[model samples]
Target: MRPVRVRTVAAAVAGLALLSGCGSAGGLESTGEAPSAVGPARLWPDLPPASAAPYDYGEGETARIPGITVPGDDVHRLDPVTVAQAGLKARTKRDSGLDELPDATVRQIRDCRTAPGDCPVLTPYYFDLTGDGRDELVIGVRLPERQLAVRAYRADEGVLTRIMSTVDAVISVELAGRDLVLRAPSVISGYEYRTAWSWDDRQQAMLATRDEILRVPERRGERTAPTPTAPAPEGSRPAPSETPTA
Candidate 1:
């Protein structure tokens, strides 16, 4: 597989040292003595994944994803979603009612049921996948039939142009540095399917970069899963509370 062309991710942190009250920092530290193992599978945007990729923590205690070189702090700075939303074609369409219970969001879902293209965009995640000093907007929208619409947008000339889009039964959408991850329940017991995307500078778009069907044994009642995960943290909505929360 072609190694992803990018730079050292730690530059963002190192750049922070130049700021006041900030100093040198550390990169991901490996827990094991041996070098990390690499997953063999390679995925592409034009193809469906044959199987899940194996996990390797790499040089860090946490699993280190290869080919994901991004400015850590930059992702937090670019409010890509708001920039995209500002240029949305459907931004003119307004949402009615408030505190009306589940019926509110449910009604919005019904209105856009037949019109999958018109579903309400819930929250968005931002990351500088393009390496152009600008962040891309990864927005997931809620639709009827328990489906989701995930898309990425780039602001060009003060206009948010739709760069990519996909639909699935998604549980969550998240932004992690250069990788935009999504999760959904699977039919297999003790396992859940996850599809992840990374910004490809060459493609000038967000591509399905990683796919994993994980067998997580730590959580209780793996048979049952709950709500989705947001890009902000473990438990939070994707909607920006203040037009861009870092």
Candidate 2:
């Protein structure tokens, strides 16, 4: 699997710095320093125009995994139903109300699978941050400044509400047994990335966050199972059966 790219928060801060500098220039105003002389206005030097590649966020070739070819030029350009199917393929089931989402929103969630798109996958397990019976779906998207867009979705009246959005580089998201676990590297201040996890309850949402840096390890759990008991030490005699009182 490709390493999930996390745009460190430091990168976003750097972008902000560049924009601030440009804004301070105030339309390229000149300082009091003397300006260099220019000859008569001749034809502008034939400098090559800036490349349009960066602006081309158009749909590209479809992504394929060995032995599995998703149908359509943009399987990434799918609707909620398709996304739900993908989740099923991943062995995850969708929350019942997920189908009620607007088609546009569902498509946006599906399209996330490719560059210039966002990938919203439904894991088999649920994360009940609020201790509510209903589990929340974890959605991932790319945001400005090389940051990630992480949100939690809960169904209400057939609509998926965005409980929250935060910065985070999601490394891997999966249904770990019965809980949803999102992993990302640690970020550094002024050179780090942001990552977060969130979930909604009947009344509110809860979120966990981290900042730039990497190689950190942690875990979170929602539901737990009963611990198995060890068998009685091989053939240890049970206390003599209680005798009935006369």
Candidate 3:
């Protein structure tokens, strides 16, 4: 016990002695080496890893940010993302996203199809998916969870209304003639799920005529009948010799 006490005191004293010469209270500390004892060498390092961009605040050199934008009116326009989000929320009956969006991200939906100027809405495809001569708007909306929503809209009397919407993950949508072909990735390695949608007059909507998980079997060839080899040429063929040929 006595030796242990002495050893503990000695260790404490040694630690204090070692730290005594470290530095004084005035020793300023910072990330970069002190420029002159008060501050760092430079507040920020040269930007752009390779080379610094020339910052000349001339007439147009200064960046001018436009005014605030928000989701606005839409008569014949639909953003794929916003529509997809709405579709997801409608289908799940739950908030698809949190309300914690940055002020910079808050945007008004603007009708980009008719209202000139540059709009944030993505371009939509037009096809008569409803069997009317007038083309209907078809859009593939990208959502979270790698989900996608294929929606079709029709504009009648200055009103754009969504008529059909289907959402799924890992999906690919295509227009085959008048039919809409939708394919989703299947768990099975070499197969996928496919659904062909065609507009039905009586149903007044797009209905899937074919829906099935199909295997796109790989094209492999097996030799059912081995290729025959040509017999040795008569002239090149060696004659059957009774004895060893000279």
Candidate 4:
């Protein structure tokens, strides 16, 4: 019994010694001083808030095509050309003070009925932009001044609703996941504007969620006129391979 007690005491001492040796090992070492934290500073707090809302580039605006109906709840089954035609006619009749489509663009739409080869409507893309199980239809109509009318439509119970509508001097249009991203050349020599429209379920429309100007180093050598202007032709426009006409 005495021998057993001694062995227990020796084992406890050995465990304590091992723990003490581990405690002598190095701990966290300081690298350097971290930069001071700077938080956003609000400026002009005393100024009165603006009375009117900020200008909306047609975001959160949705309208149903009057004459056009989706045969089924499937947007993929609808003809894109017919949808564009109906939308054009409806816009022409609307009293909204928005700029009217140019006569040349109207003619192109009309001519597409007989000559699809020369249609200005780009090949339609189907994407589940709303996160719904079904796909929505996205189409682009080439306009004058290199502007492209990018529209998104969703169909439910035979009713076709235009969920989004925006015209831009597009350098490129991309579908990043469910978001629609548009890149446009900025008046700033070395920068470009990128806007992203995202689905808003509450509004039942697509909203411009992000708009930023990014430095485009590759275009630094290209000199665009500093004055406010429209987008250039093919040079700065979305390439045909990327947005080929249907």
Candidate 5:
């Protein structure tokens, strides 16, 4: 898929501001001066292995776990752990299952897509399965005629394998005790309200629609006055004063 071209100027500016503060005395001098003593260089902390052994989900046709709905276009199985190992950050819309896939597999998937020209180069939506601190990859696709495909993957056997029923734009994904729900409007005109779905078992799948009424939160009190700005730091340059012309 091709990359999306949205510019995140605000985010870039915020990052620059943070970097600018790093060299400032106030930022680096947070800790008081230490006693004059020489110390040996500290050893780097021992860290866990970068990658885990590829997970294995027994070879066979992917079975449909009860309450899960698999999408037709999802071509492969993926292991979630492998996705994380490949340097894809977790829990954001752009974390595609690409890292989980073999290079050839990813290229093939990209080429096979209809209107691959319009597909996003980066995957959007970071999905966490099991919620044991690792995140799975999610890929979304828009077909030519208003159809949407959402696929999830976990790493297995050095390859990404798809989880059962982990596909669809509108799906009810399970989250620990709390059900991660998805709602979509029905195609029929009379059914204007959206239909809801939830995951059934620990595995991913969209279950039957369930009606749940939620109370909207009430508005809070009126707005308060803006706070005053802090004065510039001591020894910092002040704003330039205007000079009168003769």
Candidate 6:
């Protein structure tokens, strides 16, 4: 089989820091006086702490992929369609509730080899999200009603382990540094939701470290309608524009 081309985060990081100018230039130079540091103030300190978390973003939720093994510890050698199929199978075995993968999507995965054009499995991208100097497979699967499933897998001891998984009605997925940035439309007008998933070494999983709602510029001659978001299979509703919690 021909080698699959993969993009590396090491290269991306190197390119970004090539001219960062972090090193000293012969001597220490002070541009201006440093500003005074202001520590955070305690507000409502008498209030009792909440018993439970406000939201569950599925952090630290990871699983070892069944019926799949990495060949030569290379993630690129694995078939994207097969990986997606395994994920769907795993979802079915769990109590997914209303967040289950549609039957149509299951059929498409089986037909991907013969009907590549109609396959829901998108072209996979590789990145070193774990900072281990090895590329992990990043894939996106199209679901019904314009929703999408994004997942990432790593080769651990020759076994394929899924490190990150999430579903959303995504507008776009971007690789920013070592974080997987997801952009999705919000129900609120003139605003959009952004979530950034970063690798947590201590947790051994990707966590939603940053979530925000930002105002977007309206386009000319276009009416802004509320875009409804699909519920994630993990039983947590996607954050709306009003809630900026991670």
lDDT of each: 0.54, 0.42, 0.55, 0.82, 0.40, 0.82
Clashing pairs in 1: none
Runs of candidate 6 exceeding 4 Å displacement: 1-41, 54-56, 91-99, 217-246
Residues 1-246, candidate 5, lDDT per residue (tens digit)?
223323466667777678667855734334577789988875665756547436432211122222222243222333222332332222322234322434443443455456555433334445454343445455544433333434445433233444422223342333333233544335553232323333334434334335543433334664456999998888796766698556
RMSD of each: 23.7, 25.3, 24.0, 18.9, 22.7, 18.7
Model 2: CA > 4 A from native: 1-129, 142-147, 174-182, 187-203, 209-246
Error in Å for residue 87 of model 6: 2.1
- Candidate 3, residue 103: how far the Cα is off, in Å: 16
For residues 32-70, what per-residue lDDT tens digits would candidate 1 score against the true structure? 798779887755767866584364211111111222233
**Top candidate by TM-score:** 4
Give the per-residue lDDT digits (tens) of candidate 4, residues 1-246: 999999999999887776665533633344589999999998999999898666634557777877877776788888888888877755422334343466788788888989887788999999999998889999999988999989899888888888888888999999998999999999987789999999999988888899999998765666655888766976777655866577
Model 6: ten consecutive residues of lowest lDDT: 91-100
**lDDT of model 2 at residue 101?**
35
Candidate 2 weakest lDDT stretch, 10 residues: 57-66
TM-scores, all models, native as reference: 0.43, 0.29, 0.42, 0.70, 0.31, 0.66
- lDDT for 59 in candidate 5 is 17
Ranking by lDDT: 4, 6, 3, 1, 2, 5
Task: Work out how many backbone clashes candidate 6 has.
Answer: 0
Candidate 3: give the clashing pairs: 70-107, 70-108, 70-109, 71-107, 71-108, 71-109, 72-108, 72-109
lDDT of 4 at 138: 95
Which tens-of-lDDT digit does each residue in 1-246 have in candidate 3?
A: 999999999999987777666667534333586566655566457654647435421111111112212223232354454542343223212222321122222232233344434333345787877655677767754454666656665555544445555666746788898888989989997789998877766645566678899987666673257789999888998778888767
**lDDT, residue 171, model 4:** 98
lDDT of 6 by residue, 134-233 (tens): 9999998899889998888889889887778888999999999999999999999788899999999897878889999999886787866789987678
Model 2, 1-246: lDDT tens digits are 233334566677776776666646544345578978988884666876766555421111111112223333222323433434343223112232322334554465566556223444432223554445555555554434444444444443343443443444555654443334555544442232333333323324434433235534334563356999888885795766698667
Per-residue lDDT for 161 in model 5? Answer: 44
